[model samples]
Target: MAEPTLEPSTEPTLEPSTAPAPEPMPPRPAVAEPTPSTAPEPTPPSTQRKAARRERLQVPHEPVTVHEATAAASVALAGIRERCTSAPKVIAVELDIEDGRGQVARLNFKPAAGFKAASWEKCVRGELESVKYPARAAPSHVVLRLQR
Candidate 1:
């Protein structure tokens, strides 16, 4: 038997590619600057109504008696005393009750130990504002000292 001789193959070897690169993206368009307007925007109707209401409510009118003021405040604030655990022991409130509505003018609190007067101010004001008061000769200016 004759021995067979080994021969190298003649196929081409693979190599890394050198193709042309993709074109760069076009520059983004520039944004236009906002132009300043000569006149301010008009106020909405709802906002205008609210401003009118506030003006009407805050207008100075004839004043009511201290007795009238006290009675109205007592009725309005009774529920708050029962509902609020953080309520002050004593509260001095000044209010203006006009046209079936009440607005808090000032509030002073003698809070219990560890209690804060500032914390309860908003609650008291809200309660006062929610009350309905009969139209009086004028607005009421009364200082009430409520005790627990």
Candidate 2:
């Protein structure tokens, strides 16, 4: 048997090319500084004064408990019942109380089975507003349902 001999294969070897290098990036344009006229305009004195006044008007007060709010509402309801000629079967009242004053947030009525809702909403609102809450009572939303 003849022994096999190893031979070198003929293949092209890769070589580095001498190519021209890419051009460098151009310099960015310089930004101009803001001039006084180009700067944001200042708020007008009247607007500033109004904002200050509003801030001063907002005074913090103590929070009103649920019990206190309900009590106030109950007292107001009595007054409302007296003012109406014929009170509805059901009265639903929602109030927003703040700074010892109550404002009617919502008022609903379910008239008696045989009658229609009378125009007593305005009277109820006025009566509710008349109820004086605690001097330091905070803003609160209270809902009350009253039935005859």
Q: Which candidate ranks first by lDDT, i.e. highest?
A: 2
Can you list the residue pairs that collide in candidate 1?
Answer: 62-138, 62-139
> Which regions of candidate 2 are displaced past 4 Å?
1-62, 109-118
- Per-residue accuracy of model 1 over 1-148 as CA lDDT, tens digit each: 8898856446655854355788999999997665567455889999999998887745345667667667766775676786654767887876667776777767773332333456666677777778766676565656677765
What C-alpha lDDT does candidate 1 achieve relative to the native structure? Answer: 0.67
Tell me which residue pairs clash in candidate 2: none
Overall lDDT per candidate, in order of appearance: 0.67, 0.69
Worst ten in a row by lDDT for model 1? 109-118
* Ten-residue region with minimum lDDT total, candidate 2: 109-118
**Per-residue lDDT over 58-130 for candidate 2, one digit per residue giving the tens place of the 0 to 100 score:** 5456666667776766776667667874657687877677788977766673322323345676666677688
> What are the models' TM-scores?
0.47, 0.46
